[model samples]
Target: MLKIGPIFNYLQDMADKDASRMEMSIPQLMEKGYTWVLHRYHLSMIRYPKLDEALSIRTWHSPYKNLYSLRAFEMTTSFGEVLAKATTSWIIINYSTKRPMRLDRHVTSQYYKEIIPFEFDFSSLSPLERIDLEDIYPVRIRDLDINNHVNNAVYVEWAAETVPTNILQSMRPSEIDVIFKEQLTYGEKAVVQTQKEKTASNVFDHVILRESDAREITRIRTSWKNMPL
Candidate 1:
């Protein structure tokens, strides 16, 4: 139901917005060349949109400072139903030192002028459980990236491939929150561990690990919805 390209575009646009806010607070300092670098990001999508649906996004900086800046985003349908929510963690880094810098007073005050409040208890997110999932297809040489490691984005591609064929064709993964725990060296085989939880609905948790050592490489949580197949 979600359009992959557009969702990616939205993420980029939001990044730009966050950057612009940062720039406004310290034009001179920012102009002198210090900037922020993302350290972690997490996205949780509940439902995907049907074709031609208009949506709105709202974001605000949370309370964390310096070593971590918490930004939360919510996407909603035209009728105001919430579609997805995501959180990103960032750090201020000295370009020259390549080390993280404390968020000076000015930057913090500027962004959190109107902080939005939300309750998120990550402790209950459910541990990395296991389930029976389809085997990962072969990883080709081309699948490797410039770092001599598997590309982070490739995890999304692989997870999408493992969805049921019928589900794969009809719905797009509206939201995915991925955590990169480690890197995969060249030719490292990956095994996917998955779990499905249901109360009123089904939620999925998947972990990708090195096939040989069984070390976790990354975890991806994807949410799906129904549309005409």
Candidate 2:
């Protein structure tokens, strides 16, 4: 089965392609001293594609809300089976100041189209109340993206690392919600704290913190399903 990290990269790549079609690619934005940063993601998977399987991914953006933009994605198999659907929120920030910038009228009115691929609330996700397991991983240069911060997909992989071995082997994530709080850089250590939900045995909540200051970097919730026999 495909892992969440690779799936996330695929979705991001599709979004980049869509942006490029609109002449809003990362390099284009960078030339203007601005770049898009992901704020939140909600991904729900029906089934992961198998190796060598062909799939189609479609992505589109809705009208911007001030400095934020909402992008939606859908992945389908060749037979037209829906494999996954995702919604992401992003903010355009000035590269020098690192502060969010207002969406330009042309960018908002001309580029964005109102499209509802799937309905999902962008509300804040609940945090982990207690820690059932914890692990630490040192950030590596390879973990950083072009932005010089930890890649968004790495957070999901970090959260998954805290899962119990038995659950990892027997179950697959069906839904994942994530909120990125702060950036993590190379040489930093990430402490991943996780808790299994009491009410939902197959659900887990995770918080990634900077080991040095204990500052929260990301929050994630994952719901798992038993794999087929």
Candidate 3:
């Protein structure tokens, strides 16, 4: 019962562990009133690994700019079969002041820089259309991170909740690209607008907005494939 949810959760976990050992750990950053915030996440899956499969993930990092860094992960089976590729972009900001922090060269230099990263192009995704599915998701206490905002990774679940039940039952999402636009607090509710288009693939595009003013929250485009395992 592997789901896309775990794809991100596990990847984030591994990144934290590896970074901690290299001195860029989350705990260390929080002490300075600075923490990384995920702005983009893109994942492409060649196949889903079974529960019994023994998999390994190799990660590459790049310091994209003075304020932001990029990381990519390649998931593979023990036998060398590639399962998926994931890339994310993050920025460090002081939560209290809500200002972006300058890059710490000492930290960025620790990760190997040669691994190529998959670039995300938002313009290529289908434009937002009439809402086919709209729902309100409550922000749970557990979803809040040290930043006191909803964890960016949980936004995937909010978007996935709007997927049509029929599609969820028949297809598995093989690709996902998301952009985080706004932050949500504990009592706030996320109103999601989702549309499914038929082309070469069933492309689902979602526009998550704040209920109060209809301000954009997040944008996600997901493409699904038949269960090919």
Give the alpha carbon lDDT tens digit for every residue of 63-104 in model 3: 676666788888999999999998888887776886778775
TM-score of candidate 2 relative to the true fold: 0.93
Model 1, TM vs. native? 0.61
Q: How far is candidate 3 from the true structure (C-alpha RMSD, Å)?
A: 2.5
Model 3 residue 114 CA deviation (Å) reads 8.4
Best-fitting candidate, scored by lDDT: 2
Clashes of 3: 0
Best-to-worst ranking by TM-score:
2, 3, 1
**By lDDT, is 1 or 3 better?**
3
Model 1, 25: alpha-carbon shift in Å?
12
Scored by lDDT, model 3 comes in at 0.79
Q: Report per-prediction Cα RMSD to one decimal.
A: 5.5, 1.9, 2.5
- The positional error of residue 88 in candidate 1, measured at the CA in angstroms, is 3.2
For model 2, the local distance difference test gives 0.85
Model 2 Cα lDDT, one tens digit per residue, 95-160? 889888877632534364544444559646787788899999999999998788999999999898
lDDT of 1 by residue, 1-229 (tens): 5655356447646655765765622233456555554445566666766778898887777656446666677889988998778777666655456566776543645665766666543312345645757466446676664334565556767776666677677666655666666667666778876766555233467778888888877777776766343
Model 2, residue 208: what's the lDDT?
95
Query: How high is the lDDT of residue 217 in model 2?
Result: 93
